[model samples]
Target: MRKRKWSSALLAASAIIAAAGCGSDDPGTVSGSEVYDTCTTSIADNVPAFYKTYFRCVTITMSGDTVVIKTDGLPPHNTYYYGSGHDKYVAFDFSKGSDYHPNPNTLKQQNVTIQIPAAPKARGLTINAAAVDAKVNSSSNEYGLGPRGVALDGVSLFNPLAAPGDDIEDEKYTFDPYNAHPTNNGAYHYHTTSKGPLELLKKLGKTTNTTPGQAEIEVYGMMCDGTLLLGCKELDGSAPAAGLDSQNGHVHDIKDKAGTVHFTGRYHTHVCTSIGSHKYTPEIQYYDTCK
Candidate 1:
């Protein structure tokens, strides 16, 4: 990712949100040797093929049992959020919906670190109180004004929560075509369904002629606490099985391209609004901890 100076306004906004940071350091600065010392295989070298196919402009590596992902939080598509002079800038297309309105903030690069377990488990674990307060509220499942996960296009994933006295459903009016909007600090994030990741998948030929009814199992990204986020279907193109918990998560064997099982019986959440009732990314942390 490119390095850029953090604007003073952004720095002030960063003080209010936890996911804010300067894009000065390159995520790719650490060499292979420096990233995984004494561990012959680098994390990026061993990550499942799906990650390589989905994630772009980011660095992935293993730090012991955890996978360390460093991203410069910026979407790869055109949006009015990119502002007028930017090359990727595109005026917001108001034809999609009448409620479409642009937020005042513009897109700014962010340095974000996501750490997830290489092999996540169900364990039926409860999030610690401290982590809960830092990330979200335990009762309402409202996101704590920070990143809960990361999207394939290197954008952050926030839970379905709005600021005090504001409801996310009401805030949806401000979203761009991709169902994303930046915070006052310029932290662009997804609270619900994101067309950006789906568009990336389609462009990569990972999906073809997909519809809401016949949706395929698509990987979006992973949460900081080791939970994997998926669309409406499983990797095998089947609907998610029943018995998903409040977080829209369950333990199951994840399959690969050849129909071979990987991450056997691991915990994952489905944010597939097309196929399931849970339309937003994980609002509650099913795992015990997150960094």
Candidate 2:
């Protein structure tokens, strides 16, 4: 996003932490001891949607000049919605060039311990993670009539349960925009977007840096029966759907002042026929209060 300069006061504070050997050029090389020396480590007091059904914890350990972080949890599902529901869980590969795929093994478990060689000193770093959980059934109303081929065919579009044309957005369904399909007769679901990681890092009080592998992590969420157990769309300041709560969803770039970080949540609707429609309701029983 937009470049941010650390305030003099913040710079001074960061300097103190960096001078103590907490700062390094390489994030992957940071040692556990170094983190303990310069940084105050604390875990998220409350669990987010990623851990609602599954137990998860983030551990930051520092030794001398190293920072070690471990995330332990499991992905809610193996395969989710691609662009269209027509495709099943393909294989997991960033190079595959497909919108949908199987959950990366990197995000499968809650326990991910990373040993960085060094932590950046000039800029702060952020790490993000999430997960989803849902029971899959083939005969349930949650499954759609099959993937909506390309255009908005007779099959349900956004939500299979909707009466059609209820919340159709001309821009979203057009060929230029590339319409999305229903998944497994359940609501449409997809992979984690930039928003998740950004939010995770901001919650940890670290700004994101573009340095290679400086600030990054695999984030995952799941959908079931045409409903989002976790995650939400990027709000445009407009009022949300009726009965849907705004606080339940995630806000993109919570720390960015200029909105430089461009991240949008995935849309998963019409995978199920009885779920009604997609309303961008993300579940967040617990979240870190922004400072």
* CA deviation > 4 Å runs, candidate 1: 1-43, 48-50, 121-143, 210-215
Give model 2's TM-score versus the native structure.
0.21
Local error of candidate 1 at 214, Å? 5.0
Model 2 stretches astray by more than 4 angstroms: 1-57, 73-107, 119-193, 199-291
Model 1 lDDT tens row, 120-140:
644455534333332334454
List the lowest-lDDT window of 10 residues for candidate 2. Answer: 148-157
**After superposition on all CA atoms, what RMSD does each candidate show versus the true structure?**
11.9, 20.3
Candidate 2 has an lDDT of: 0.26
CA error at residue 113 for candidate 1, angstroms? 0.6
Give the alpha carbon lDDT tens digit for every residue of 1-291 in model 2.
112232455446654664565523222122222222112223222322122211112344444433343433211122323323323343334343344333212212222343322221211112112211111232122223222111100111122222233322321231111122222333332211223333333333333431212333212222222122222222121222333222233222211222422223322221111222332222221222100
**In model 1, what are the clashing residue pairs, if there are any?**
217-233
What's the distance in Å from true for residue 130, model 1? Answer: 20
Tell me the TM-score of model 1: 0.75
